[model samples]
Target: MILTDTHTHLYSEAFDKDRDEVIRRAVDNGIERFFIPAIDSTYTQAMMDLESDYPENIFLMAGLHPTHVKEDYKRELKHVEQQLKERKFHAVGEIGIDLYWDKTFLRQQQEAFRLQIQWAKEYRLPIVIHCRESFDEIIEILESEKGDDLFGIFHCFTGNLEQAKTAISYNMKLGIGGVVTFKNGKIDGFLDQIDLRHIVLETDSPYLAPVPYRGKRNESAYLINVLEKLSDVYGRSKEDIAKITTENSKEVFGV
Candidate 1:
């Protein structure tokens, strides 16, 4: 069965010592596709190098992450624009408001988010959102910009049923990840109520590792743990879940 990890930072330094082995582990476990999200201009070269190393499996995205928004955000956005003009990317993402860590750049974050959404529409590409402690703010902007051209995945979604429905209303697929396997990760409670077509799997790896691996560094191969949890949550076979979620990912990323 082929599985898609719609959001993962394979270029992250966390896997610097054994990046190839990490990728091989995932591929051997049937998780072939890895969608890499952009954080800032600093990681652009590393991301390119990753794609260069594994062109068949790596898909790139260009955008300034909300947390990275700062006084020099304008220059960063320019870099994103230049990258888009120079080549191809499957999406513009891992962008949105993140108020959890620091609210100092709240206004800048909102502006960056809106500008990136406009860019996504201009390029006719999907957006992968990174939302944290700002669901209301995120939904408000999405409401103002809602339309046919605005569509993507809500990466690492950790909201309630109403928020999930709201995200779906905006043409976004819920990106389920290792959190679903956590005993207290509430999304699992109501996930089955939402149709499988609106869900996609992700690891956000080197980050939210699934149970049996929780509290440790995450990897794409652990996506199997997530798949197994989803299978139990939705009462479907693991292969079926893989097929449906991977198909859902294709619909969002257009790959």
Candidate 2:
């Protein structure tokens, strides 16, 4: 019953007070793997410290998040490049266009996204995308870059059936998270139609907490809530969902 949280910010300040306890609770409940995504150079040390504390469970990624793309983005990308060269990361991710908050940085976000994808290809690593209201924009880039070397997870996927199929076409596994448990989170409506092989579990924790915990800070242990929802959605046992999604994660992260 091992479960993998393919995208979570365990290093987030939200967990600063009781990080160990939060992680222990998840591990005890079978969510043993936590893949951490990068936002910017600001959290690099914190991310490293988290991995140092839980070497067995923590897998880190290096990339500049789309929302974080600002005037100094080039400097930030340099940091991402340096980290990738100096250490091992399971993926290059949490990167993509995010037009939800503001459209001001859309151009910079697109450039950063494309550059990161090229870096991922160069490093021979999977990419974990952070898409938000920019599906059409992201899909255009993906369509142009589709290839054997360009593949990864579409983190926190909240798209329609056609979008889901398009992401799968680009070798991306849909990263199902707490949103699936929401009454109005539409992904749940068509999830079962997509094969379990193309899906992976996540919490995006400290954010997007599942029902019963929604509107509150989320933790990896709450992944059980997501697993339960998915079990109901796909008509499979919880253990089977855990096994399949964890395996799907391993395929993407190569761990």
Candidate 3:
């Protein structure tokens, strides 16, 4: 079985202590692919180092995360554009709306989001979206700018069935993470509304860890919890879950 964690911060400082060991555990449990999302230029070196250390297992993406948009977002977009032009990236990603943190950068966030989507379309690479507390606004932007050519994943999807359908209409697959296992995550209620083919597994590690490890630090190794939850929700074996989601990920990242 080959499990693919479609989104994770393998370069996160939180993994400084024993990152290798944690990754080894994930590998032992069948995780073979890890997609690392770039937040900004600040973490570029760390992400590069991670890919350098684990060349075969890690794939890198270049983008400015929504929350990371700041006063000089043009420079940030330039950095992202330069990186995209100079090298190959799996996707233009971890980019979307985040009204949960601050509304100050709302316009900037939408600008960055649309600009990144343009880059993705120009490059013909898929995207990975990170949305929080602004689904309506996010949908608004997507509806305005989205077309047949733009497609991607909605990372850590926690929305209801209708939202999932809306995202799907935009050619985005729903990235199911640890949220499905939470008592209040609630996405499980609509599991049957969407099929397994439109689903992809992700840990969004060093962030949203699954239950039993909830409130604790998340890591790639914890994807097991997500696998178990998916097995239950989809009524499939873990190996099947891993295989299908891995296949779905390949369709997105073209790995």
**Runs off by more than 4 Å, candidate 2:** none
- What's the lDDT of the predicted structure labeled candidate 2? 0.95
Per-model CA lDDT versus the true structure: 0.96, 0.95, 0.91
Prediction-by-prediction clash tally:
0, 0, 0
Model 1 residue runs over 4 Å out of place are none
Residue 142's C-alpha lDDT in candidate 2?
94
Instruction: Report lDDT (Cα) of residue 105, candidate 2.
Output: 87
- Per-residue error at 159 for model 3, in Å? 0.7
Stronger candidate by lDDT (1 vs 3): 1
Please report the candidate that would top lDDT against the real structure: 1
Kindly report which residue pairs in candidate 2 clash with one another.
Answer: none
The lDDT of model 1 is 0.96
Better of 2 and 3 by lDDT: 2
Assess candidate 2 and give its TM-score to the true structure: 0.99
User: What stretches of model 3 exceed 4 Å from their correct place?
Assistant: none
